[model samples]
Target: MTPPAIPPPGVFGHNRSLVTPHYAMMPPAGILPSRLPGFAETVVRFQAAPALGARFAQALLEIGAGGGTTAPRDDGLEHFFYVLDGAVDVTVGGQAQRLGPGGYAFVPPGIAWGLRAEAPAQVAWVKRPYEPLPGVAPPVPRFGNRADVPRDTTNRPGRYIQFLLGTGDLAFDFEMNLMGFEPGSHFPCIETHIMEHGLLMVEGQGNYLLGRDWHEVWTGDFIWMGPFVPQQFYCTGWGPAAYLLYKNVNRDVT
Candidate 1:
């Protein structure tokens, strides 16, 4: 009889999770799962929060079929939800819409909102306190999908960007965007800016420069960049790389 084949080890000797004063690189493999108060049958991995030096909170959620919020919730905080896979029904201010992959919705502060998974689903959730600007009215609830947004390729070859939320209006204090890059493409220069960011890698792989270190990141990874921390990205692999980015905008420095 042939000897029994050995199975591979289940545990690795090391992990890739990294944290710094300026940024954090959290791969899905190293994330600790948790539950949220209003959600059921879901796994939540919070990537950025005030405890991590970020003004907003970002979480990646995996919901089982038939699982979601127990009831509508309103915490006086604005929210943005983007579906990464499967199907979900999101309700904002008593209006409900079924969202599939790449679908997204934004709920303004003080409005009631909730979600229910029609199938097993993955989603990115962002929450932040509304920053009021004098003479500017607060933004209203909006919903759309990535397919509906036009990609702007005028910046350069192999690079494209989509502003999911209109940036021309001052009433909007934050922005969510989709950025894509072909293999071997990269940012024109290292960026150091006032706006902090919560970025979720949605597709392909890349080398991301955070502060002074370059880290290999792939799909399902999440990065948090604090204000003025230098950052840049260089795409790798055979296909394209893309990320969903959240940044505070249209507000004066306090």
Candidate 2:
């Protein structure tokens, strides 16, 4: 479904941003509240700090056909784009690729990447600056469709996960991956982590622990977390619950 264009942020552009002292909940009331430059035929779920108390930002962006970014973009932040519906063409680092649902592209910091919507498309836009490691080599651009990637459900029998970039050699300061839970399944314990998160629900429904509250979340919902915010999930809907997760990694305590 092609999403309707949203009003751009006002000249003052202050109200769209907010600071959730503890946590925030955005149920599927079908409202996307924030908008800024660098997009077209798109609506944003939310953006960076003061609103969510996080250093990084993630937005649920929907682009209509023939609508996309204004130019090849490179903002010196590592970025990832995961397609949720329709199709898109991305050209980056001398490589151009077309992605349908479940396709993803990773462009490392400073690489030129451009996007065009062939069909109306919804995407998860995740961004954060790289925390450089002195000895590790710089990362490279990678493009792939998740259908071709392994879910590797062996060790994790009933559940499924296709790790897009959580591994030994990826050399990134953050991790972005896909996770699924069978209906009625849940985490055994609450988890507290130093890495903050930006989670976008792609499918199903569930109750999630955020800070001190449990909020109902379903497809099209986005959740942000600051450091050590208590978190966990329980799937209660008719089908599996799945989400694309973004979390900072490979960094140290200040």
Best-fitting candidate, measured by lDDT?
Answer: 1
Best by TM-score: 1
Residue 110 in candidate 2, Cα distance off native in Å: 0.7
RMSD of each: 2.7, 6.8
Clashing pairs in 1: none
Query: What would the TM-scores of all predictions be?
Result: 0.93, 0.84
Task: Name the runs in model 2 displaced over 4 angstroms.
Answer: 1-19, 28-40, 47-51, 70-73, 154-157
For model 1, residues 1-254, the per-residue Cα lDDT tens digits are 99977644423564567898889999877778998788988999989999999999999899998888946455799999999999999999889999999999999999898899967999999999999887877998999999999998896689999999877688888899999999999988899999999999999999999988889999999999999999999999999999999989988875
Model 2 worst lDDT run, 10 consecutive residues: 10-19
Q: Clashes in each model (backbone N, CA, C under 3 Å)?
A: 0, 1
lDDT tens digits by residue: candidate 2, 81-161: 899998888877779898989999998888888778967888777877777777887688988887887886766645787
Q: Number of clashing pairs, model 1? A: 0
